[model samples]
Target: MEIFKSDKIFDFMGKRLPFLALSALLFLGSLGIIFTKGLNFGIDFAGGTLVQVKYEQNAPIDDIRQILQAHPKFANASITEFGTPQEIVIRISGSSTELGNDIGDTVHTLLDPTGAFEVRRVDMVGPKVGDELREKGIMAMSLSLLVILAYVSFRFEWRFAVASILALIHDVTIAIGALALFQVDVNLDILAAILTIMGYSLNDTIIVFDRIREGINTSKESKLLLVINESVSRTLSRTTLTSLTTFFVVVTLFVFGGEIIHGFAFTMVVGIIVGTYSSIFVASSFLAQLKFSVNNYRAREAEKLKKQKEKEKMRAMYEKGTV
Candidate 1:
């Protein structure tokens, strides 16, 4: 699907500064929001017992809170409407299966003494286990970013790698901040969504970088800016098609995927939008900031060739026992 004119040249760099300013605002604001608001970690990361109950009629959210607070065991339980007014989910910190079950019975008796409310589901995770998972999750994300850095450096130049990394950071941080802003439950599924976002963000940036490299290699493009503009313009169609298609699918998931997958779908929807923008604006503008050009590439290559010859000369000397 050709969303943009193939032959038309777009001056993406013309409004680079404004786009960059906007990205900075989002990136910084996301960071600030994350630090202040924090994530509402699910049982996967924050050890807890979850009890999902459904009543025959509209659930009494306020009464449920009051009753739970009155009972010492159920006190501090997080209560949220699961799917509808009739369905409710209660979460409490701690992970004793036997005790959680006992507490579930207590909740059922207190909330619906008539037994009309049904216990739909229950889950538990140990505090120690949740701590471990949280640590591992952070480690996983950190390692992924490091690996991306190394991989991009290998595939392209350091300038491209740095630009790509910054864009990805922009994408993920903002996504996380959105989660924090809305107080979405952070679980294993959300973690998976984030990793997927990283991959998508990288793919988009890499496509632009690849096009720039191809353009530079084939043409005597003295000004890297011109080549960057042309490369971005050429790849716009592919990027747009991918993003739009993915957006539609995720939007569908968000609408009908149910409560279990709602957070995951929401993360994907936000990530796609942020990833697309960062790929086009954040990554390209940062790359431009490095002042990299065809001349720089040529110079770097020449230096590599010089060092290679020097190494070869030294190897020959060593082979001949000439120090």
Candidate 2:
């Protein structure tokens, strides 16, 4: 089950160039998506009305969409299956063209009574609120990154700090890109999910980083690279077990958490797997190129000891003179 055995430590050395080139390409692609396609902001950001409707019998989601789209006000309506075929969720843009209470009333008049239908929930978001929310989301994400960078750098070495944060940025960019390409909704819940993903991704990176630090600090016998390789190998079981457990939880949520939170669950699932990969290929790999000098570490320790001795000698001489 172990991929990185004693003999396999040098396996990646041959493919370093290829890996670097591919990583550069992926980074560039992510940057391009960020600047060009951008994020498809959800109702929470762009402001919109979300209407959840339930029916007694299974109904066509398309029929409900068609019904709403017929209205000029609800022309931009998008409908999706909520819980069951009988349940449908609708989204209408929140702008000057918003249908507001009129759309809800129309659904009640047009679709209710004739069949067993009821409005389960309705939420309206204003454009001003959406603008503020968009700004807040950006600020929160930026703050989280800054905090992670500082914490990781303080806790570990600068190389680890750089690699861990880079992996995080990589995961976030890839997640956002997937969202943009697939047109996933970027709502408040989804924003929460993205932030949660960042945290989750950082947790995975930190686990490996922690192991790397332990390997370096304790192992005078093994080479640095060998120590790291072993550290990753030893932690494989725990990593796999944790990831599988999380995967199942997310899958359950995606399957049964209802449509309202489905996007959030989906985002978590994607982030977890991406986080796992980045910890291995992305973060661990970077440690090999890290600027670590045993001489520097030894010199610092010697200097600290010398300073302590000098202070003690000075204190002893001062005490003797006083006596």
Candidate 3:
């Protein structure tokens, strides 16, 4: 069940410069979109009221929107169908307290009129709390990257760690930028998905790095680029299979998981695709560009040996009563 058998050599590192240039273009374009268009932030981070309602029968969304808009308080509310035609979720820019305790009742009465609809749930977040959560989300992402940097540096080399971190950042930035580009609602669930993406991407990177290290130690390939190219080619089947399987699951979720999980699934789909690409082209290619070769390791080992020899010489001199 292997997609790539016989150790097909694709020369992934051969086009490293072109791939890197394309990635840089994408990264910059995503940044532009993120800054200009901005994200469609949901109630979780924007501070608002979220009401999920189910009607006894299918109701016209336009009629509901019109009725809500007629009222001064609900004029600027956002209304959309949730899971089905009979269910709808409404979001308004205000906390429960600010909107008053009867907010749910008011929506039910106004929208249903004959008490045919029921408010399934109501949630709210104040502006201050929303701001705090936004800050915390940023901090969480930053800290995760920092921790990963430290871990990878300790486990491998600093150059590999830096390249891996950059690749991860590329994946996350592209994911977030996709949200802003598509106007997907950025929520806490999506934030969680992004963090999950970081972990997933890191695993893929580590796998490739491990293979590269093994190749360096065992293979007679003198060129670092050749070793990396061979390593990526060797692991091509595993990376492809894993990404394809995960992609299918996320695509299913995006198609059928309803509005609640739509953003999360979408984020995963984007993350997986970007993560896989970065592991091969971005992370591995960057490692090659950094000149990660046997020479670097040999140089370090030589320095260590020199220090050890110096210490032994000093010990011998001291034992022999020589200055």
Candidate 4:
């Protein structure tokens, strides 16, 4: 089905300055939020205990919170309903293995003195391990971007690669910034989501870059800006269709995937939207601003034509002499 049938001719490059300015403000604002407010690190990144408890019936969340607050050891714990009203997950900050063992007993005694509640699971991550994971997560994200830069530069031209990387950075920064702004809990799953976003954003950018390269090589458009605009217009339908389908799937996951995958789904939703925008506006606009080194391509083509003419002249002279 065609969502957009007519070919669009949007002057994306013509309005690059304004779009870029908006992106800059967003980027800076996100950075500010991250630095000031910081992310709400989950148990995976911050040392903590996660205890999952299932009650025989629907338990009052406020009663559970009040009970935990009554105890000195569990006073600062974060308690939330996991999957259903009958199940709740309790998170406490610490690396102590003893706490993991004792927490279940303590919560069970406080909530259900007769043992009506069952401790389904108790997980703990040490502070040292959390620190390591945090470092590795950062490294993984950095390495992925570096590898993408190398791959794109080799596959296309350096300018396309640079623009694509910048666009990816923009997508990631905005995604993380949104998470921080909204106080979403950051964990390994969210880190994985950010990496996934990078890959998705890169794929979208590469598609646009591929189309632009094809236009530059074949189209007789005198201006690079016009070539870019035409390329984007040609791929507009495809981009829209792909983004829409992906968005529907992610939104579905966000709504129904439960707390376990909530962060992942949220990241995907943000990434998809930002990625689509960057592919069309940010990446393509950079190409237009740079003029995509059209002069070099034109000069190369002219040299090739000159060489062909010289060869033809020599061939003609040789034929005449033979005659």
Residue 211 displacement in candidate 3 (angstroms): 0.8
- Tens-digit lDDT track of model 3 for 249-307: 99999999887898899999999999999988899988888877676775676798899
TM-score of each: 0.89, 0.82, 0.90, 0.88
CA lDDT scores, all candidates in order:
0.89, 0.76, 0.89, 0.86
Error in Å for residue 61 of model 3: 2.3
Each prediction's total of clashing residue pairs, residues at least 3 apart in sequence or on different chains, is 0, 0, 0, 0
| Regions more than 4 Å wrong, model 3 | 299-323
lDDT of 4 by residue, 1-323 (tens): 66555476778788888989988998899999999999999888898888898888886788888888888878789988887888889888876565646777777778885336899998788888999999999999899989999999888878888888889889999999999998988999899899989989999899988888788778788788888888888888889999999999999999998877988999999999999999988998876666577768767767988999999999998999953
- Candidate with top lDDT is 1
Supply candidate 2's per-residue lDDT for 170: 85
Off by over 4 Å in 1: 94-103, 298-323
Q: If both were scored by lDDT, which would come out higher, candidate 1 or candidate 3?
A: 1
> Where in model 4 is the C-alpha error above 4 Å?
100-102, 298-323
Worst 10 residues of 4 by lDDT: 1-10
Give all candidate RMSDs, comma-separated.
4.2, 3.8, 3.6, 4.5
Q: lDDT order of candidates, best first? A: 1, 3, 4, 2
The better candidate by lDDT, 3 or 4, is: 3
What range of 10 consecutive residues in model 3 has the weakest lDDT sum? 108-117
